[model samples]
Target: MSKVSNRTKIAAALVGVLALAGSNLVAADPLADVQKADGQIHADAAASQKKVDKFFDQAQDMLFEYGTVADERESLKAYNDYVATLVADQEASMKAIQDDINGVDKLRQGVVPLMFKMVEALEQFVALDLPFNTQVRKERVENLKNLLSTAEVTLAEKYRLILDAYSIEREYGNFVAVTTGQLNLDGKDVLVDFFNLGRVALYAQSLDQKTGWMYNPETKGWDTMDESHLRELTKGIRIARKQGALDLFALPIPAAETAK
Candidate 1:
């Protein structure tokens, strides 16, 4: 009919070009891509949040079941099954996190501070309680600090190491050991048998079994115990080291000084 307007011709040409290049400009599966990305973000958030939720769930369950117990076997069974399911779900959620962008860095920012605090607390405990294997303990704390600073070590491994340290420290409270090391006795480095009696006492025995000293935390010095107590100290060490039978014996137990 009538001649088409120039504007209409230009519009038609533009539409043709867009159609030819549309595949390159626009994503073919935009919704699919969005769904995948959103799922990943959600999964990552869920992964971390689920652990907290599970903890609270256990707490609440305990609170609910504390005073109410209609059927012992049924309740116990149900509770155990629920806990198992929660654990499985938590594992699945963690696995579902996106490989490229799982918010682990953000988690480490919060966790690194906690790890530092734990280490500091550990250091203080070692300082106040008893200075046994001190250099070794210091090295362990230093290693943990260095590991935390590195990018290669994962957060989980760091946390596990801290827990292991704590466990070792706790286990120390239950056991005694006889280790020989250098001790500064009266301004002299003496090679002595350190008798660690489960944080209850710390004693140093001379090579000739002639002298014994108890650790004094106040001045960080060693006070020589009475030679009359030598038999008791020897028996105690023998029992602790499993070299002899255990029997009741009176040995020096260092009293922790009250802070002024």
Candidate 2:
């Protein structure tokens, strides 16, 4: 072959070799690139996790501070918004870190709203003070005592009949209805009214557990229920207040019945 042709052929072969080497070099470090990308994703995911944690912590602190109306309302709104924003932002983040976590975003959704409601209830309770020695408080307590007595007598009699009439499943429902119904048979809103009245009495004693406020039949005077009984009784009162069941402070108290 001619030297020029030979040189051209050698040049063409070198070009082919260079192109093949370049292709292999490009293919060599795919795993390294993947690892670098993974590391970056992990770092970003960690940053997002920090943001999520911050939001939750802020929410928790606000919930604990939810005593006053203004403070609670403002803090609650901010906390709720932060949680909601986190949830909204989570969808986009989930795709990025699906392999790293399982249902982390969804877990907050159920918990956050419930916490929000609980704080809201506590806010209402603190804002609405109970009436203790006032006529409304005194009259309501007497009315509840009367209603409880009447209901206890009536249900004690009818409970047997109810048990005879209903199946086991139906009887359970009947029992609850009979118990609560007897409590409500009299025109008095006994449970909630009594709870509020009792709460006021307890509050007046300055959170003292030793003070008893139940009616003392022998002394004919109200005696402290003591700390243990007070704790039990106050739990119901707090629950009623927190659940907004005791929001009828403006309602007129039922007239107390004369003893038979």
Give each model a TM-score.
Answer: 0.57, 0.23
List, residue by residue over 196-227, the lDDT tens digit for candidate 2.
Answer: 33322222122333332443223323343456
Candidate 1 — number of clashing residue pairs? 0
Query: Can you write out model 1's per-residue Cα lDDT over 106-170, one digit (the tens) per residue?
Result: 87788889998998898778777666888888888788778778889778898999999999889
The per-prediction CA RMSD against the true structure, in angstroms, equals: 35.2, 35.2
TM-score, candidate number 1? 0.57
Worst 10 residues of 2 by lDDT: 176-185
- Please, what is the whole-model Cα lDDT of each candidate in the order they appear? 0.83, 0.47
| Candidate 2: residue 228 Cα off by (Å) | 90
